[model samples]
Target chain A: MNTAQHGTWNRLFLAWLVAAVSTLGALFFSEVMRLPPCELCWWQRICMFPLMLLLPLGLFPLDPRVVRYTLPLALAGWGFALFHWLLVLGLVPASAQPCRRGIPCGEVGIQWLGFLNLPLMSLLAFSLIIALLASTRQKVSP
Target chain B: MKQKLLFALAAIVLLLGFFLASRLHTDARQEETRQHTALNQANLLRMHSPTLGPAEASVVIVEFFDPACETCRDFYPFVKELMAAHPGQIRLALRYSPFHEGAGQVVRLLEAARRQNRYWETLETLYASQQNWVQHHSVQLDQVWAALQGTGLDLERARRDMEDPAIAAIIQQDMADARALRVERTPEFFVNGQPMPSFGRQQLRALVQEALRTGGN
Candidate 1:
């Protein structure tokens, strides 16, 4: 394999590892810590869960062509995570806010273990995936 | 070729570092807010019960609850489970606020149930069936009358007590206590006289454990 091929494989593996860890970390935080997730957090989780499988599927064919398909998934996940993180940080107001009934999302403990809210962690994971997909690009003929 | 890999790795490291730094900033801010909330809780607890706990208990949990609030009903089971698990180590006090309209009767029925040594039972039953009464236009004497039937409560006395000035006074006192604490919600709690900033069972347990370790008042 050439240097570029080797680098692509390395980046893909690293990205998948990050995505897996982030997803598992989120599960542990919610289940073990008993931290109930809010609605936006739930949506972000839904968006990320599929990528956990999709990214690994991309690796099976070892085709750079897979990057074209995976890139959209990465971008979509990143968009959801970005929106959720901003909602958590009060950067953007939450759409379809779910606080009217029970413990408002804002009231739940944010930034556990120094600084990891559900959304920020999701953002980190999505960002890693995007970085990996971006790295796979080849220069196009003009 | 090696330089590119190193660059990619470096970028990853940098991004992770930025994420960690941002998280730390938010955590520090939340910690400060928690400290201020704790101080406010301390003042409120002092006004209500200066000593904090029963003379022999290991921890004290003070909850400010509104009878008609849906969230309070949702949180009731969790609190009950905590109390059951801790038993003698945990002392609990329920302060009532009739924040929602027509909650006064429910509060009175609860107090009457306490008089009969069935406070926990009736409280649990009421919470389990809160949906029935909370949606009604009026929870006056009729609601209390209906709630007492088949709950093993003395319906006649429960209804009589609903109109008792003393019952009204107790409810008023609870509202006053809630106001002093700056409790803005239905199910606010204080562990060892410190405001509970979060509602998860593990978080509540951790707070209680911290109080026990500190030899809480």
Candidate 2:
């Protein structure tokens, strides 16, 4: 394969890897860390989990347009995560918070580390996937 | 081609590393919050002298109650209902608060009843019949003791345990715990060491169910 072909594969593979790790990270938080997922986290996960299948499908057929198809869905997922993170950080009023099991999502822990909590991390992962997909699509078609 | 694969792997690893680092930081924050919570709860437990339930139970329900408080009397049925719904899942730790007139004597009598292993039955009976006895200020202490005759309890031991200093300390520690938790009224409930907000019975039941589902982990 030429350098361009190689680069295209690399970008797609990286995107898949990042998406998988993020999903697994979410699982670890929910199952092992015992932090229950709020409604927003669940929505993000639902959007991302499909990429586990989509990534491999895109890789085998060498159809970069596949990434385009998944990109919109993934972007929408990130939007939810970003909105949830903003609600958690109190950038917005709690009326925007998602309710799960009768408890508001904002009431749970806010930021994790200096920046990333569940929602922000999810948003970052989704963004990375989007960037990789876009880059790979450009390499394949152009 | 190999270099591209190497770059991809490196980028993926870096992303994972960043995520792990952030999670570690969150874990540290959670640990600090947990420690602060535990210490606060311990202090409250020490002050209130609340009765300790079986240490083996997965969930602990600590309650602050005044024998003569109408609210406390009203909450008794709810408590009984909860216990009935989730048998052995929860252990009830009752702390007597003498904030109301005649509550101290009633608490003593209830503690004394524990010597016969009839503490719960006696407490339930008293709560169910609170209006009948709580207002009789001139009633003799022995008459209260006599009321337990048909419950198949040891009347003598029940009377004796009422004044036990050890029991008094337990009750006091519970009161302190309630104070620390900022519980100002009777019938305040704490599920697994967390202060429950004022909510309806359905909401409270849902909270407990969620706590159970989470295994209190």
Candidate 3:
């Protein structure tokens, strides 16, 4: 209701923006670019896609409790993104491969700016959303 | 009132994004197909690439494949089945893409098997035991050799032949042709010198069927 509340709402909006962009980007890659998601990417999408819907609902009311719902999704997505990053980096062993068919998870499909790939991009987006939600949790708590 | 406005705005943006994406996809596909249409037919085949089915078959399926790619391995049987269904009417020519980390070695091994006239058997052996040899998206060369045991190939000769410069040249030539065709992924197929309208099993089968109906030998 106050200026401080408005600021917290802005952070929530920022989190929503990140989720929206990530969700749309994932769609663009799969639907438009025709790059099929591997199993790990699917798991991560399961986590990220919901945040795009959930976060915006919290924004209109400026609910600090929004962090309660969105943070979990962001965290789980972050975990999957981390696992995928490690898988592509060859740190995850072959025995753990979830993609037994279709596109292999370890195949680096898109490389932007020389080194940044899709898994890394997903990792960064989830990380940013988590950080934003964590900060909003502290500032908006009465 | 503000909440309704915000939700409506979000919906609009999402819908616009999806619409834009679909348009982009259509335009890109048209451009890609046009480019593929202009590609020289000679770029799609090589004398040295592994071929199956009757030599005089009117329908030729050229596949850009990676030995270490799982989809390529999985689709191998389906492609073989397609050729079988058509019998002598459909011929298959495999071009090595070898985009994976250790795939180059496996391709080299397969080429060596060709020297001993065991290319098909060696490829089958590798596909049957692909999981054992392909580790962390890279080919385990030793495991690949172990998997090839049932193929009755002379391993020593194959190994020595793997180092042959001519084999390397074959790989290089296939790769150059793959580039010419703009093949960025494994298991990409061209039926009768035509690229798939889109990439999938059904699309490949449909293309082959069309070819068979119109141009069967």
Candidate 4:
């Protein structure tokens, strides 16, 4: 209703944006690009897909408690994406990787900027969501 | 400044924990593999594995395919084309990969048909009618059975044979081989034990050609 409340709501919208973009990007990669998802990709999807629905439900009324729900999902997704990124870079050995067949664990189905691949992009998006969520927080005592 | 530093440090530790946990978990898996007893030959290819083309052909194509996979249905004709082109020079092996709901039941149907010496016909019929039954991630079994009427299958026999423990064992073996080979998707093809270099119609043709040249015999 007031200016400060409106500002808080808009800032919180970043969580919604991250969820929408990442979910659509995943669907586009699978449905449009015809790239099959590997096992880790599927795990990452399981984490990311829920936030798209959950974050938007918190909007309209624009509750700050949305962060409490969305941040846990974003963190879990970031963990999967981090492991996936390391696997892609061969930081994890073939013997130690979950994706040994089908599409392989280290495949870069898409890349841009000479550095951004799928997992990095996922990690970046999740990091932004977490940061945006944190920024909207009104100081907690311990 | 101190709060930001602490937040950054905590984030780093959380990430490190994930990475290390994955590494340790896979390390344990690798150790398990080293200790795994020799895999049974039956797991790799049962005596009853489905086949197309010649049984003793020089080139063997092992495709791990789920009955409910749309991609498998799409790839079916291409596989047939390759076999037709090569005549008796190539053999196509079908390994069950019932990764979808109701896919195991379809596998049982196919196995039962194999018992009646009607495996190829049943496979073609099921694929041709995949759209009618595979609805919203579930199989319409009654529709599938309806489509099978007057197809020369002894319907009563098929129903009885579907419950056979042999069929269960065959499906169980295929799933194990799929896990051992790390097959995560349907329509995965291996030509003479060599995985297709990449997934494409052209890549499949190319791999089959390479196999034919080197070991086609």
Q: Tell me, by TM-score, which candidate is best.
A: 3
Model 4 Cα shift for residue A35 (angstroms):
12
Candidate achieving higher lDDT, 3 or 4: 3
lDDT at position B46, candidate 2: 39
Model 2 chain B lowest lDDT segment of ten: B44-53
* Residue A69 CA displacement from its true place in model 1, Å: 5.4
lDDT winner among the candidates? Answer: 3
Residue lDDT tens for model 4, A10-44: 66665666777687778767754458899999988
Alpha-carbon lDDT, every model: 0.67, 0.70, 0.87, 0.79
lDDT per residue for candidate 4 within B75-186, as digits (tens), equals: 9999989989988988888998888788899999999988998888998899898998899767888978987889999889999999999999999988988888767788
Per-residue error for A10 in candidate 4, Å, reads 23
| Clash count per candidate | 0, 14, 0, 0
Candidates 2 and 4 compared by lDDT, better number: 4
Q: What shift in Å separates residue A56 of candidate 3 from its native position after superposition?
A: 3.8
Cα displacement (Å) at residue B172, model 1: 6.9
Q: Indicate the worst ten consecutive residues by lDDT in candidate 4 chain B.
A: B33-42
- Better-scoring candidate (DockQ), 1 or 2: 1
What's the TM-score of each model vs. the native?
A: 0.50, 0.45, 0.69, 0.55
RMSD of 3: 7.5
Q: Give the better candidate number (1 or 2) by TM-score.
A: 1
TM-score of candidate 2 relative to the true fold = 0.45
